[model samples]
Target chain A: MAGTDPIHQFVISDIVELFTIGGDGTEGSGLTFSFTNSGLFMVVSVVLTTTFLLFASRNRKLVPDRWQLAGEMSYTFIANMLRSSAGSEGMRFFPFVFSMFAFVLVGNMLGMFPYFFTYTSHIIVTFGLAMTVILVVTIYGFARHGLKFFKLFAPSGVPAYVLPIVIPIEIVSFLSRPISLSVRLFGNVLAGHITLKVFTGFVVSLGALGALGWLGALLPMIMAVAITALEVLVSAVQAYVFAVLTSMYLNDAVHPSH
Target chain B: MVTQAFAQEAETPTEQNLDAAIDATRGEPVEGAVGHDPTADTHATTEAHGGEHDSGVFPPFDPATFPSQLLWLAITFGALYLLMSKLALPRIGGILENRKHIIDADLAAADASRQKTDAAIAAYETALAEAKSKAQGIADQNRETIQADLAAKRSAVEADLGAKLSAAEARIASTKAEAMTHVDEIATETAQTVVTQLVGDVSTDSVRAAVAKAKE
Candidate 1:
């Protein structure tokens, strides 16, 4: 009964009060500068990512040790993903893509631990990341190709009659990219965590019935364990999906064609 | 934001229903009802605290935390990007490049050494063939010089022997002629003496003639 609140885990509570502007930070009415659990985790993710990479690459051996290999493998993995989705020219965005990937991936993995806040589960956080990607793509596209960046919607080889229908649809879909991108990650993390919490809650609730209930709790316990594993996999996959999609969107900025 | 508000509105009813269901189950009259009451009371109080904390809004959809979260995200992500670009990526790239260079250098050195060995073997074979031919040439020259000297010495010995044989034959012929003349004179003298003794005071001329006729 105690752990039965599935929605309670997502609560963002302040650890330190910094300042507030325009209002007293109540009823979503003010710009609060308080450091919350979400901010703490963000800092944790950054520190952890930087420390691991820096420590892993400390000894640059010709025949790399396990740690160095891990560092090198992650480097190549993001590099290859970007280069394949975009071209070698896309490598200019390597730092950005790598940072995005590391941030999301680390955040997701950290959330798998009990009592850890899942920042990626928040729509606003995911949406901000998605919007940043879209902003970069748009700005770079316009800078590089000028008005021709609009050509992404009006693809070539469309029949003249279908162009009227296809262009608007394409435009709408294009406009929906950040929404879809942000929602996909947010929804997956939110739902998976909720389901895991719910199942785990069932175990606690049923086990309150004593000996008979303990036997019944086994099924939910197993389900919770299985869903936790699945959520771990989903966390990694969603991060990869975010990075890959970012690269592909950047590709449109670089090429801006069908 | 509106959709999220609607979603929160929609989710609250279900959560309340689930909470009610849990409470109903805990409220069920069991053998250990007396013991379960205290635990149920604690659950109710904790639920109240959770409700106050959440404030009827889903935490993920709560706009109050957005500014702080976004600010932190920007700060942390910017720091991560700078660290990666400035430090980690270049180091890894350099290590890989260095390894490739070393391996290529090693391969080139090995190739050069193999070529030197091949050249040395070829030179050794050529020198051996040259020495063998030179030895054969020296042996042939010695054999020809010795054979020429032997032929010259045999010819000189044969000419000297032929001259000595002719000279000896001539000397024997001359000595036999002289002996024949002497023998004729001696026979004449002996015939004359015999005639004088037989006839008293016969003439020398007649004796000589008779001796000549007998000899004839």
Candidate 2:
């Protein structure tokens, strides 16, 4: 902890790396057709989410226990947001929306643990997620609304005289959803972690004065704690916003006239 | 026989006191009462709970097999989506549809009732107006009949009075004429008698006096 290089120390290699197999002589990496770190993390997130929901939903008492209540509240929060934005008609999508929320929330929280990578901070992962949602929305829009869904690109009540100008702008704006949604999540996580890394680097570089700089160390410590809390909030909000927007997109699929 | 059986069932005095003492101290479990019991049951249950390898607790991560991550995500997402579509969604849909139907029916019934109440109120008002008009018409008819009856009775009385007055006048005239005739006849008879009795009687004067009195 004292003599290490914090900047280089936190650098996670992009290549698939091997992890030990317990009581076996096998090696595994992300693409090795075996268990991988990212795969394990994904599995962990799923298992955690599943167990929590199972335990929480077991009795589903009107007066909920603590963990059950927390789970229920999370579910209701996302569901209500979707419903409010997309209407009761959007309740049909609750399962997908709920799963998305749970997945993103658990993934963000799991990455917050020491020795884990912020998977969402990585572009490949974020891009993949973003593309998946975008693809679903696109296909659904077409399947549900047909050619009328293309009207989503051309908003109604826009003055016919302004069509040439407005349509292009609208198209661009509509296309930006996936990009903006993905970048918003990716940027927030990447920025917070990077900021943490830099401050921690300063704390290490200050040498024995690092302890003397303990008072100065309070700054990074406060930022870390504050940023951690903010990150959790951002995690929940991003998931909610994403789900809500997805529902809105679906609403457009259902009613392209709007 | 009952007394003997009761005595036989009752504990001896020393044993009864001991039983009371044991019940009293049972709150403090005897040290070895449960101490010798094996923990096999607990161990069995713990093993049963962990029958699956899914503890959900954080474990080591390996990066070599990334595809499995995608596979797990795909599988879970697929299963959940399918189950939602197949099972949970249909039930939720039915509940929502039923709720919607009930609400719509209630609203419709309320609307129908409101319309019915409005119609009833209108009819009542109309009936009240008609009754008022009928009552007014009946009163008018009664008034007209009473006025006509009074007029008819007054006219008949006036005509009868007029006729009677005329008849009485005529009778007075006739009576005056007859009186005059009688007077004339009486005068002639008196003159004849006076002339017969004594030529000294003034038959003209007496006749003139009688005529003047009759005129008066």
Model 1 regions lying over 4 Å from their true place: A24-28, A156-162, B1-53, B108-216
Cα deviation of B144 in candidate 1 (Å)? 14
Model 1 over residues B1-216: C-alpha lDDT tens digits? 223333443455454544543553544643332223333343344355542234446889877778888888888888888988888778887887898899999999999999999999999999999999999999998888888887777777777776776776777777776775566556656666666677666666776677677767
TM-scores vs. true structure, each candidate: 0.69, 0.53
True contacts kept of each: 0.78, 0.22
For B5-100, candidate 2 gives per-residue lDDT tens digits of 223323343545334334434434433322121232222222343321111221112222234445545665565555544654344344445556
User: Which of the numbered candidates is closest to the native, going by highest TM-score?
Assistant: 1
Clashes of each: 0, 12
Q: Please state the error at residue B113 of candidate 1 in Å.
A: 4.5
Interface RMSD of each: 3.8, 13.0
Name the weakest run of 10 consecutive residues (lDDT summed) in model 1 chain B.
Answer: B30-39
TM-score (0 to 1) of chain B for each candidate: 0.39, 0.44
Determine the iRMS, in angstroms, of model 2.
Answer: 13.0
